[model samples]
Target: MNGRITVRIMTVVILYHPTMLLNLSSRHIPCPAKTIFGRRGPLVIEIGHGNGSFLRHLAIRHPDWNLLGAESSLGSVSRTFRRLKHAGTTNVRLYHGSGLFILRNVVPVNSVHRVYINFPDPWPKKRHQDRRLLQSSFFKLAAGRLAPSGSIWLTTDHAEYFDFSVANGKAAPHFSVDTTADPPAAARKTKYARRWIDEGKIIYHARFCKESEPAHPIKPTITTQPGTMHHAILQGTIPDVDAFEKQVHAFDSGHVILLDAARPLGDDRLILFVRVDEPELTQELLVEVRPHEQGVFVGVMPFARPLSTPGTRAAIRITSRWLEGCGLRLQQQSF
Candidate 1:
């Protein structure tokens, strides 16, 4: 451990690049495999699928499988869609967000057949290594989604990272490092794979099998209650909306920071964009405060289509409490 460089995780997990999402990418997946594929099928997930050639091949090669690619860059998602569309591949679907988000919130437990993390961002610097996806924490989270027979296929051209992944995968109790080899034929054709190989760089490949289900997997219930959405109003005076600058409110489930607000002239609703960070998930969505007959209504914006979870309901409460703190009289409220 003397020469081993320490990798520190970056706290700010930015989900996506706004330019990359641009109406093309599907919204945050609340219900992972069910909503997109509509039926149960063999699920294959690829994280940070750059350029998507890796995903397109998997889709075309295996027509019976449901392929989901979670990429953070808009350009990556758009280009992948274009390529898959050109190939006329229908089983492939894309989501523009951190791979962690999809694995933690979207994909159902024990539903994935395999996970491909091919030539992921090395984040080579010691300080940025925490951002790399194959760490012990990530492996635990990813393992939670793998079926009894599922395995994680990881490949990288960075020698240090490859060693780190192997060591990290072993550190997690529920997984076993099954094998290591040169990049597989299917992955050897990737842009990075080829570039590194041509430069005489050695790629590290590992097949990590799930030995047992994680004892304490993150399984937060995602379903929203009856009063979670519409028709339920919070009866409170929403004091003047002037002091509504950026504010961070912490609740039991997680913390939500009101990023900013917008009032589309003449609209009945006041839109508040906020960042919600919970134990298993992180989402940036809108909480709308609309004028109600009794007082004012604060709820998750439907158009934004956020995951209706405990954290989101907590967001509704946070917004309501912020109003109460700002001198709003809360007689009765509905969650």
Candidate 2:
């Protein structure tokens, strides 16, 4: 086998960022979500960037705006990082954290000018409906973090997910959702989107903008017990180490655990992933672990409901104790 030919073949599918005589280091740091880039340039955030093709295209096409991408999958993250590095593009930042986590913590409230959720996994099972990212709670959170005139651009091939997204967006108290069958003329098209269109899947697009607040305040909260500290760590938020260890102890000895310590491209933020055997349970328990020094940081664990509940309080106590024992501080946030 000719290795050179094989490498060339692989390169065809992988797109790289173009090299410019700009400061690449400065563009690589992960700043707080509210932090603006490029002085007067509009800030754009893309969630679930697959191979970074679309993002790369957008970055090249719109040189004035700063582009930020959040991709949770490690494979995708590696691919994206390589694409950006090879292309020598310095105007984009990549995060290995979840889109929601980035929006909540890294992004400052009312700082984002545009948001994109493209080709996200469509949790098809009825029982797994809550896993969909376009749910009511997500909409509310996005609305809160979005700038007044900022807009959310969503595209999906799954008809059900698309319709569900529209419904959730419309029902959202703050957003006015608008749907389109075609991509906006100026929007960059992704390979996935183009493929879906060619395969006769009617692509669904929606633009959600916050028009006003709800008549009644919507307090969105995610509740999980203390023993689930690892969940948050994987989501790229700081985690309570003591509680995390206790949660780990609760697991069966035979269970598999995986942890990846990663630094986002262009930022000081460190992303730590604690993976477990049970996918569903793992996702539910995710907490954000942020490191202050090299190894120390605070963990914020959100409750599915208010922590005031007796059961919830008990779980938090046990988890807090475990985290303290492990040398990590813990904080509980209702929202």
lDDT of 1 by residue, 1-335 (tens): 11111110011113233321222224343455655766567888888889999998998899888888988775677678777778987787777677777777667788889999999888999999888888988888877888897989998888888889999989988888965455568798888888988999877789988889887786634533333452235565444455446788787777988877666587767777777887646666667777877767777765433556667766777777776676766656655
lDDT of 2 by residue, 1-335 (tens): 22543353254224232322111122311244224343556778889988888787778788777787887764686688787777777678775557775675455566678998888899999999998999988888778777777889987889999899899989887888777456654333676877777888877788998886434433323323323332211112333222222234233222323233334466544333333332212232222335543343334244221111222223334334534655554444321
> What TM-score would you give candidate 1 relative to the actual structure?
0.77
| TM-score for each predicted model, relative to the true structure | 0.77, 0.58
RMSD of each: 8.0, 12.1
lDDT of 2 at 38: 38
Task: Judging by lDDT against the true structure, name the best candidate.
Answer: 1
Instruction: Estimate the overall C-alpha local distance difference test score of candidate 1.
Output: 0.72
Off by over 4 Å in 1: 1-35, 171-174, 178-180, 211-227, 230-244
- For TM-score, the strongest prediction is 1
